[model samples]
Target: MRSSVILLLVGISLAFAGKHSLKYFYTSVSGDKTFTATGLVDDVQFMYFGINTKKASPKTEWVREIEESDYWKRQTHLLVEQHHWILNTIWTESAGEHTYQITYGCEWNDETGKTNAFRQYGYDGEDFLFLDLKRDEWISPVKQGFRTQERCNNETIRLVHWKNYLKMDCIETLKKLLTLGKSSLEKTVSPQVSLLQKNACSPVLCHVTHFYPSDITVTWMRNGQELKNVKVGKLLPNEDGTFQKTVTLQTEADEWRKNEFSCVVKHQSKTFRKTLTEKEIRTKNKTAAPFDVTVVVVLVAVILSLSLIIGVIGYFVYQRKLKPALSGSASKCWLSFCRISGYVTANTSPSDSENTSQSSTES
Candidate 1:
C-alpha cells in the first residue's frame, strides 16, 4: 500500500531549494467513514483531515502559525467534498462499499519555471482513472472505469480547472507552505552513507539512511564517469518519517580496486561522495566492531528504543487522541506513512481566494 503511495506522491522540498510539490492523498476504506486526507509538501506530510473529525489538522509545529483559520476551514470543506466523492464514486461503481484512493498533486521547479501536475485514481489496488495533463486526456485502464472516463471526457470545464489548479494554484500553495514553514522545512539530517557488502563477491550496496527532505541524488561514478548499469533502489520511508535509499553496483569487487569508483550523494546543500574500497566496506568477515564496542552499541540502542517506545506511548496518553497506533515496522511502510500523532500543525490552499481553491476542489 505504501509503495503504491510512493509511486503516486513524492518523498518530498523548500528553503534549501531545487524543486517542490504539493500533493494530497485521500483514502476511503470499505466500512470506515472516518477516512483521512493527507496533505504533503513534497514528501513531508504536514496536514491531515478526517471525515469524522471534520477538522483540518496540522502535522508539524511550523504549520501551526499559519494564522489563517479561514484557509483551514476552506481546506476542511474541500477535503470533505473530496472524501465523499471518492467514497460515493467507488460505491456507485462497485455497487457495494469499496476502498479507493486518490492521489493528486503538482510539481514545481523553484529555480526553473518547470511545472507538472496529475490526478490518479485507484480502486482495489489498481489504476482506475488518471488525468494526463500533458495530453489533456483521462485514461482508464480497467473496464470498470469506462463510465468515469466518459464522464470526465464530457466535463471539459473540470479538466481545465484541474489543469489550472495543478499548474498554478498547487504550485502557489506549495511556495506559500514553503515560506510558512521554511525554518522547519529547511531542517535536514545528513545521510549516513555506508558501503556494505555481505561478502567479497556480493552486490556492493551503497546504503543511505536517516536523511531528511528525501531529495537526495545518488550516482555511481567510475573514475568520475557516470555508470549506467547500477541498480538504484527506491526511496523508502524511515521510522521517523526520514528516508533511506540504496544504490547497488553489481560487479566484481576488483572493479573498484582498479578504478576510483565513487558513490556521490547530493541533498540540500551537502554532498557526500564515498569511494569504493576494501577498507571502506563493512564486510561481515572483517568490519565487525570490537566485542566491547558492539555490546555498548547494542545496549545503547536497546535503551533508546525503550525510551522512544515509552515516550510515544506517553504522548498518546497525554494527548488523549490516537489516529493510528505506531508499529515496529514503521520504516517498512513505504509511502502511506503511519500516523503517530493526532496533534499536527495545519498548512495549503488554492491559488486565489478560499473560494477559488474550494471551487477547483469540488470538481
Candidate 2:
C-alpha cells in the first residue's frame, strides 16, 4: 500500500507539470536606435543578445570589430548578423553606431550540464533593440562606453522610451500574423452539421474546432429561447495552440424534425445570435376608435334645444306687445253678429203682417 501511495504521488506530480513554459532573456545594447521583435516558442526560452565593446566575456573575445555591413551578417552560437552594417554581439561597443542581427532559438541543458549548445535558429531581426548614439543626462554611454562599448546600458532609465517605440510598431505586425493564422485555422474546425446515418430519424452532430481558448463560448438555443438544461463539454486547446469547444443536446427526433433549433456562439465582447426560424420576430400595434359619432349627437341636441328656447322667447315677447291688436279683432266679430240678429227679426215681422192682410180680404 505504501509503494502504491508513492507511485500515485509521483503520477500526480507529473500530471501537474505544465506542458508549456515561457521565458524572456535580454542582453545589453547601445545607441539611440530602437528595435522590436517577437517569436513563437514551444518548450523553449526566449533570449536576446546585445553587444558591449568595453567588456570581454568568453564569447566577446571572438567578437572582432568589423565594417557596419559585416557587423550585421556575422553569426555566433547565440547571436547572428541579420541586416547590413549591423554587427550582432551578446555585447555592444561604443566607438560608433553599428547594426546587428538578433536571432531566436531553443536550447536544452544536458543531464550532466557541462557545455552550452544552441539549437537551430528559427527567426532573426534587425531592430530588436534601439541605441541612442548621443549621450543624455539619463543614460550617458561615454562613461560606460570604455568598459563596455555597448551604449544604452542603463536599461531601467531608458526602458520607458525604448518600450514605447518598439511596442507600437512591433505589436501591429505581430497581431497581423496572429490574425492570419487564426483565420486559416477557423476554416478547418468550422462547425458542419451533417446527418451521419438516416433511418426513420437522423441524428446530427455539430463539430466546432480551431478556436482561441480564451475567447470562446457555445450554447444551444431551442426554438427562440435558450435551453437552461444544456450539457456542455470541457474545452481543450489543440496542438496548434488553438482551442476546440462543444455542446451536446440530445433532443427528440421530432424536436429537430423541422430544423427549428439553432446554436449560438459568444466570443470576447460580441454576442452572435443565430436562429433557424421561418419568420423574423416583430411587434404588433393597434389604434383605438374615435368619438365622432358621440360628438355629432351631442351637437345636434344642443342646437335643437337652443332653437326651441329662442322660439319660446319670441312667442312670449309677441304676447306681451300685441294684446291690443288681438282685442280689436274680437270686437269686430261681435259687431257683425249684432247686425245679423237685427235683420232676421225685421224680416219675420213683415212676413206675419202680410199673412193677416190676405186672410181678412178673403173673408
Candidate 3:
C-alpha cells in the first residue's frame, strides 16, 4: 500500500525544494504477514510494497515503464532480508504478545542538499532506538532501548554498512527514481481556484484544487491587507495525481459585501487572486435529500400529475391519425371520433367519400 506519511518538511520556509525518500516499515507481527516499504519522489508515491502483495510494484504509470527487471528483483530481495533480520532481532518470548516496529529510511532534498536519514525502532508503539545521523551512532531515547543501542553500536561492520547505505546507496536510489519519474513527478500543473460557501449564512471558503508541487501559499486578504487566523486545510492528493487545498475565512457574508476581500494563491510561478463576492461564491449547498413527510408527499403528487397529463395527451394524439385504407364507413367513423375530440372538421364532399371507398376496396 502507498504510505500515508506526509512529506517531512524540515526547516522549510516556502522555498523551492525537491525531496525524495525511501521508507521501510517492518512489523514483527501477524499483520501484513511481514514487511512493507514505500518510495516517494517529491512526496508523490511512485513505488511501494504492500502486506497483501507478493512483491514490490510501481504505483505510477511512469514507474511501470521501467525496463530494468533487476530493479524489482533487488528491491524484493532486500526487503526479504530486512524482514528476516528484524524478525530475528525482535523474536523473543515477548514477540508473540507485543508488536515490534522498525522504520528506517533515507530522505534527501535535491534542491537544498538537505539529508535526513534515520533508522528507528519501536516496541509496542513506544520509541526504543534511533540512529543519530550527526553523531554517526545509535541513540536510545528510552531506558529499554539501551541494550539495543549498545549492541548495534558495538557491531561496527553493520553500522558502517547501514550508514553507507543511507549516505550513498540511498541517495543514489533517490536520484535514479527521480530520473525515472521525472515526467510525472516534476510536471507542473496549475491549480483550479474558486470561492465556495455552504449557504448564504456560512463562512467563505477559498477552494484551490488540482495543482502540482505541494509547496503552495494560500492567503486571505481584506482591503488589500493580509488577513490572519484563517483555517487552512491540509494539502490532499486528487485521483488524477494532483493536489488540493482549502482556506476558510470564518466571517459572516456581510464582510465581503462591505469590504474588498480576496483569496490569493501562489503555486510554482503562477499567482491567482479570487475576489470575494456574492456572485463568486457557489452558495448552493450540496446536501442530502430531505426526510420530511410533506416534501415526499408533494413530490409524489407532482410526479403522478405529470404522468397522468402525458398519458391523456398521448391518447388524444394517437386518435387524431386516420388510416389511408379506411373505407367510406370507416372514414366516417374516424371523422366522428375526431370531431368529438374537436381535432378534425366534418367537411367532405359526396364524390370524395365515394372515391375513398372505391380506393380502399381496391387496395
Q: TM-scores of the models, in the given order?
A: 0.68, 0.23, 0.59
Candidate 2, TM-score vs. the true structure? 0.23
Worst 10 residues of 2 by lDDT: 114-123
The C-alpha lDDT values of all candidates are: 0.77, 0.39, 0.73
**Candidate 1 accuracy as lDDT:** 0.77
lDDT score for candidate 3 against the true structure: 0.73
> Which of the numbered candidates is closest to the native, going by highest TM-score?
1
> After superposition, which runs of candidate 3 have C-alpha atoms over 4 Å from their true positions?
1-34, 64-68, 91-116, 121-129, 137-159, 199-204, 221-228, 254-261, 283-363
Candidate 1: tens digits of C-alpha lDDT, residues 218-259: 999989999999999998989897899999998774566678
Write the number of the candidate with greater TM-score, choosing between 1 and 3: 1
| Residue-by-residue lDDT tens digits, candidate 2, 243-287 | 666666566544564667776776533445544332321112122
Ranking by lDDT: 1, 3, 2
Model 1: runs farther than 4 Å from truth?
Answer: 1-16, 31-34, 95-98, 239-241, 284-363
In model 3, residue pairs whose N, Cα or C atoms come closer than 3 Å (at least 3 residues apart or on different chains), thus clashing, are none
In angstroms, how far off is 79's CA in candidate 2?
Answer: 28
Question: What's model 3's lDDT at 207?
Answer: 92
lDDT of 1 at 173: 71
Q: Which is the winner by TM-score between candidate 2 and candidate 3?
A: 3
